[model samples]
Target: MEVVQVLCMKGGNGDTSYAQNSLLQKKVISLTKPITDEAISNLFCNNFPARLCIADLGCSSGPNTLFAVLEFVTTVDKVHKKMGHELPEIQVFLNDLPGNDFNTIFKSLPTFQKDLQKTMGAGAESCFVTGVPGSFYGRLFLGKSLHFVHSSYSLQWLSQVPRGLESNKGNIYMASSSPPSVLKAYYEQFQTDFSMFLRCRSEELLEGGSMVLTFLGRISEDPSSKECCYIWELLAVALNDMVAEGLVEEEKMDSFNIPQYTPSPAEVKCEVEKEGSFTINRLEASEVNWNAYHEEVFSRYQKIVADRMSREKTEFVNVTVSMTKRG
Candidate 1:
């Protein structure tokens, strides 16, 4: 099956305010640290080699990716320092969709390298950071190569928008109410994409490697209620307004759907268990209200809410960390 390369045109034009919301950044880094530390510590303690290979799947083009990579490496360096051992050389592979704005990522690398040198000192250790564009559902590295994998805010997107929406069966993703058929299609796509993810990673990760994943998720099983994400509602309203203004075609609005699948925490755990290769180490869920007023190009179409209660109350993104010990 061909994978749909996940692309976000919304942030490609250099309007990074939406992508760099302070609350969103704090929540993402807070949720990721424990998992990242665990994975790095496990890999280092295993005594695999003098060099470590770590990858961030679905790493979009921005300073956020650079921040995350540096955070992980800094943690690893600290661990090595505590052990009274020389810091190991690290190679960070940044993987994203083929259509990603690699120019932006590449332009920021030199600055990152300088920051690394200033913080860790020139003689501490060497670290290589490079971008590799591709779908995560395929092999991006050699077998038994990677020691750790990390992804955030990117797993909820399916390989593609679900097929067969025109048959009147149902739409796969809904802004408000969802039909049973739509729910079924969403679940099936998740299962397929997630299974392919496991199969691909199983080959790329070494026997004692680890992976950390975080994404938007639903806390309830009800298909009709607003339990998933508020961004969907906001986007739906924006699309509707555009359609009414003739800025976008009506049929295109009907056919156009955001590629998303907000699986429940239990459902995610079940799928991971069934894969049988990775063992869950920790899972946690939290919510963050990522709304701030910014007089930027992207924040021009702002909506005023009466209170926090009206901003669509849904569970925060879910984070899961897992490990695989080569059997």
Candidate 2:
């Protein structure tokens, strides 16, 4: 709940907005396209639904918000054509936390709907899209209401920071200096959150319905892996640097925890088995460069900014990220 109150992305198409920084997220959706295609294949193996209900959980406000959704729409249209079945009426739910810039998403829908109509041809009339705002950690829809669900680069966010991390000092998340207790707290929290997530989806999805989730994950159990918590470690370093200049209170740094976790594949599999709801059809992972765009551009930009801020007494850089769905 605190995460919801404090969690908001860089709204609008500004320099630091999620709308601009989300190119990496768009890339993740593309990288996981095969998984989504396989899930859609299973969804339509039998008679396709005349009216199909799909939900894109953690659909943040950005130009790329509809990128994955349109892919699904096209795939569904193609499969029905191949099977000689009528195209289904598609009702899409774009979900995110309350703090999301839904205005941006809604504003763009007018153009999106028009483009979709042109692309979908006669099938356009059957397609409907609406926004569903709230957390996905709990039940969000009626029982058996959803046929297919997709989440991209979300779900790593815990419902809240793990309990008992207040004792953790000087770091915002699990880092090299973090103790065993902090790691244990994070692990337990993830188990609880992931199991709850599965349970809720189980109630909402029809029998044999499919879901595809692509989020940040660890390659191993080590919590300090560069893949696991390097981002947080860097954040801690930056915050502590500010504290040294008497800019930020030490207590503030100690109290704040990044309300997210990068679960290992084994951890996710274990939770699914414990939940005993959905059958795991496909599980795969691959490493990709963190910067999907030109890395040199960022390096040059950082250098220019560092030169200008040499004697700054305070630094207030508000980086609104497109990671609320579960990042």
Candidate 3:
């Protein structure tokens, strides 16, 4: 599929002050720590560098991104303290799409620095955090320069829309009664994106470094289920309504498609194993009831659509996959 970059108007500022704090972000961060600690301990125990370089890929501008990175660093600090060793100088790189709202990220940095200073202490080793904007499929750091990499709520986005859909063979994502074409397109994109991710990370990670990623996913191969996700349906309804109202052309709606894709747990594991560089230490899939937060966020989403779109839609459900990586 020819990848089409849909230019979407920026919606929210990535803040959740008014949204319900289901603590989903906190839980994911907490779950991420033990895996990170284990990997770092194993990779750097004997050859702990004075400085540790880490990258958080697909780090959207928000408290969630900051929270996850802080939790990981704090955990590492505790591990070093328990071992009677001084904490390594930490350097964290936050990465996301080029269009991401960097102002929001930058504004939060002072608070992040203050908390870090308090937790690790002013006399403790220094830790530097900076934002790097780009796609993860490409190079973002110097070769063999990083000790660890982490990404959350990212990677499920296809690098581009799948091709061959005009012929009815189906592409990476489409609105249809049956979703086989959608599934195939998603699988192909994942295969490409996963390969690029490995190739890029391999170039930047030390010989024994590790990576951890969390993303939305599915447990079953069935594509036409409510469990699969309802975002497609909601979008279809919204688009149809807009077409009926002559807000957007019918042809434009036909060409537009969702940029997201959700892989099954088995499919993800297969790709990781096939990559040959990463040793899979853990692969877990779980149902995440974001209902509380969904209720709050979707309400806001509906209002946004109502102003621009012709209809309102319901909340969509999503599954989550957490994976650990080792070189």
Candidate 4:
């Protein structure tokens, strides 16, 4: 699939919109708050930039988008105030695919600004927020412009679905049923895309800049582990059932696959090492349980997910990594 052209969270503030269904992502932002705080704090302390430029990559629209930016700003404000330094003029960029709900984010700016003013008092006046629409796998900012970068619940999405996966039929992702070739293609795609991401960010980040990233991951070395792929697997099962009922085309289902990969910590470390632009400051994994299940309101697909999750008590593995650009 053409991810940039097609990939976007459901827009606007409706019941089915991403803005409403993104509680999980909000939890993820909170989950990695400490890491993000430290990254911003360290960057500010090392070299106080009078004008601080920060980017939240894959910053899908909603409260969660600005939540991250607010956290970074809050951290810098606290650190600088503690050190008795003047507050910096904060230039904030929210980045995502061209199809992202930038309009929703823009419309909500008044409230975000008010909240900022309420939280930071006079210091909030110096903050400027803007949206940059593009894929982060390529350059999105000027060279050496950003000091601290943050991405949460993103980057597990690949630039595109892996090539040569015709044999990966019946499964939408790297599942246990997938053949060796399918798994290999997925891993290779992740390595390529992640390395490119690091390279682009390195060019945009100032010397000694920091990045804190959180995304779906696995604790196992196995590429087809259930922790990473079960969600997709269950999704595939629903799709297959639809195919069986003639509600969807089998050919279309067979041709489709999710353009995402959940890398193990070792895989992430290896790619970062191979890219050779940044040093890993910290890498940690945590498990988060699936949210409470409600059977009364669920559709067939939701029921499938809820039922399996209830039975297995499956938890998603989140990997958060902190990195610093070398001088």
Candidate 5:
């Protein structure tokens, strides 16, 4: 699939919009606040830049869109105030796929700005927010322009579906039934995409800049572990039911694969080290219950999801890392 053209969360503030369904992501932000705060604080104290440029990559529109950025700004302001240092001017960039609803975020800017004013007082006027539309697997900022970078609950998404997936039939992702070759293809794709991500960010961030990234991951080395692949496995089950009933085409279903990967902590560490651009300051893992249900899909899928949830611990393994750009 053309992930860049199609891989976006549902837009607007309606009942089924991502804005309403992103409690899971919001919970993630809350869970990782300390890591984010520490990174921003460390970046601020290192150089104390007059203008702090911050970018939130894959910042899909919704209440969670600016949530992390505000926290960063608040952290810097709090630290500077306590240290008796002048607060820096904050430049915030919210980036996502071009298909994202930047309008909704733009409309919410007035309230976001007001909130910042309450926190930063006079220095709030110096804080500016901009929307950058594109993929984060490539460059999105000028060289050495950013002081701090944060990406949450994204980056698991591959730029596109991996090739050689004809053998991965009847599965939407790397499932327990997937062939060994299918698993290798997925891992290689993640290695390439993730390495590119680190290289791009390294070029954009200053030597002392910090980055905190949080995304879905697996605890087990097995790519088909329930923690990471079960959700999509359930999804494939639902689609197969539709196909059997003649509601969906079997060929289409067989060809479809999710353009995402949930890497294990070891897999993540491997890519980071292989890329060789950033130093890992902290790496941790946590689990959160899966709370998202799509309204667009038929009730059968929802029922399958509900049944699985009731019987088992349907949770997402989240890996959060804090790193600094190598000098």
Candidate 6:
């Protein structure tokens, strides 16, 4: 399936919407907060821009959206306050696929502005937030425009499904049942997409600029390692369960695969080096247990999954693929 056509965090603020079901993503943002803080702090202390431009790529809508923006703005505000200098005009660019539910974020802006005003007080007035709807795999901003870039639980998503997997057999996304060729396709797609990511950012970021990214990654070189890819296995199980009931075509199941891949830190480093744009100042890997989710939220999520499969099988695949990546 075409990723841009299908890839979206379930929209709106309803139960199945990414807004309601994104606690795991919030945790990722939180887990990476200090790193985020340091990146921004380094930007300011080393050579602070008069007008700071920051982009939150794949910034799906909901609380997590502004939550990241809040952390970024707060980092700059605190650094400026400590330095006793005028705060820079912070331009916050929120990015995601065009299908993302920007309306919720837009509606939340009034409150966000108010909260920022309340939190940062006078300095908050300098921060300007705008939404840019597009893919981050390609150029999204002007040359040397952004200072600090943040993307959490995203980047795992490939720009599209891998090529030449028409007969991958009964599996979806880096599963043990997948053959070596299938796994290779996933890795190649990641290498391409990630190289593009670093390449594009290299152009957009100023010298001495930095980026803090957190996404699902494997501790093992093996693609079938549970840490690397159990969620998709479970999702395939869920869909196969539906197939047992004749709700979906087996052919659909065979053809359908998630447009996402998790890389090991070594793989990430290799691609970053191969791209030869940005230096790897740091690389850290963390894991979140699959059972960390509350049962109530998961039940709602499962219902949405079944509904999406019934409505548009690949649509369910697309959204839940994103959800599991975040988790």
Candidate 1, overall lDDT?
Answer: 0.70
Q: What is the Cα-based lDDT of residue 166 in candidate 1?
A: 54
> What C-alpha lDDT do the candidate models reach, one value each?
0.70, 0.76, 0.66, 0.88, 0.89, 0.77
Clashing pairs in 5: none
Residue-level lDDT tens digits of model 2 in 88-129: 899999988888898998888878777777788878778888
lDDT, model 2, position 257: 90
The digit string of per-residue lDDT tens for model 5 on 10-58 reads 9999988899889999999999999988887787554577888999998
Per-prediction TM-score, please?
A: 0.86, 0.88, 0.81, 0.97, 0.97, 0.88
Clashing pairs for predicted structure model 1, backbone only: none
Q: Over the stretch 144-171, how does candidate 1's per-residue lDDT look in tens digits?
A: 8888998887888888887755532122
lDDT of 4 by residue, 213-241 (tens): 88899999998999988888887888888
lDDT of 4 at 84: 92
Given candidate 6, what's the lDDT at residue 172? 77
What shift in Å separates residue 209 of candidate 2 from its native position after superposition?
Answer: 0.4
Q: How close is candidate 5 to the true structure, as a TM-score?
A: 0.97
Clashing pairs in 4: none
Position 157, candidate 6: lDDT: 87
Ranking by lDDT: 5, 4, 6, 2, 1, 3
Output the lDDT of residue 181, model 6.
88
